[model samples]
Target: MNGWNLAAAVLLGAGGTAALWGVTTGPPARRVIAQNMTTSAVCPALLLLSQGYGRPAYVDLALLLALLGPVGTLVFARLLSDDLSDGPPSARVLTWTAAGAGAAVVLAVCVAVGPGRALVKLLVTGALLIGGNIIASRALADGFQGVRGG
Candidate 1:
């Protein structure tokens, strides 16, 4: 496979492994954090795979994931509000790391695609992914009490 595809594979493998381990073996808070992480990890890999496969459509899927990831996390946060009420779940290092990776992948894909509408879409997706990651992380940190009117 090409460098892009290979990179995607490697990222998916390592991230998927870590996320799986985290989701399966941790407390409810940690598992939720790890589950949130799964999207951050996969979105960029989806972009990379899109670039590698020469499929612009996959970018759309990435965008969808970027949009939905935080919503899903928020739902989880709402459902488990009691479990998380003790304290917010903060994984700052992992959160920023995932955001950085999404940014890097977006940049790489943008470079490969050059200036065009595609670039704009990629930028939006990246923004959504990074923004969503930050928002989800923060919401979890706050235990989403604001969302629940607390």
Candidate 2:
């Protein structure tokens, strides 16, 4: 594969591996964050793959995952609210790091594609990926405290 593909492979390998480990061997709260991370990791890799392979399908997949993955995490967080009542997990560091990586990858891909419908889609995907990620992380940390109080 080319450099893009290789970059994708390395990212998937490193991020996926770490996320997998965290998910499999942690408390429910930690596992939920790890699950969110799965999306952060894979979405960027998918973008890289899409660029490397010159296939729009991979971008579509990345977009779908970027949109859905956080929803899934929020659902899990809501379900596990009891476990998180103590306080929001201290995951800001991890969350921002993952978000940063996603932003970087998206910027790289956007540069490669230049301006077009594809660029628009990439920006949307990146926005959703980073925006959704922060939103989901906040929900996880807040654990519906405001909602429950109201």
Candidate 3:
């Protein structure tokens, strides 16, 4: 496989394994955080795979994941708010680290794509990914009480 594909493969293998392990074997709060991480982990790999395969269309998959991943996490956080209210997990470091990674991936892809409409799409995807991740993490940390009440 080419370097991009190889990199994508390695990332998907390692990150997916870790995310699955964390989600399956953790306490409620930890599980939620891990679930949220899956999006960040997989979206970048998908982006890499798209680049490696020379298929711009595959990028749409990553875009959709960026948009929907956090929504799913937020659903979990809301439904499990009662369970997490006891001492809501604050994975600030992990959250920011994931955001940084997503940002770096998007930036790298943008640089590779250069200035174009595709670049704009990548930027939008990156913004959604990072913003949604942060919002989901905050909801998890706060137990989503505000949302529940309103």
Best by lDDT: 1
TM-score of 3: 0.95
- In terms of lDDT, the poorest run of 10 residues in model 1 is 141-150
**Per-residue CA lDDT of candidate 3, range 1-150, in tens?**
888799789889988998999999968888989999999899989888888898888999999999999999989988888888887988999999989988988888888899988999889889998999999998888776667755
Query: Which candidate, 2 or 3, has the higher lDDT?
Result: 2
Give the clashing pairs for model 2.
Answer: none
Off by over 4 Å in 1: 146-150
CA lDDT, every model vs. true structure = 0.92, 0.91, 0.89
| Clashes (N, CA, C under 3 Å) per candidate | 0, 0, 0
Residue 147's lDDT in candidate 2: 63
Tens digits of lDDT, candidate 1, 58-148: 8999999999999999899988988888767899999999999889999989999999999999999999999999999898888766666
**Could you say which candidate leads in TM-score?**
1
Q: Against the true structure, candidate 2 has what lDDT?
A: 0.91
lDDT for each residue of candidate 2 in 29-125, tens digit (9 for 90 to 100): 7888899999999999999999999997679999999989998998788777878787567599999999999999999999999999999999999
Please give the ranking of all candidate structures by lDDT, highest first, separated by commas.
1, 2, 3
Q: What's the lDDT of the predicted structure labeled candidate 1?
A: 0.92
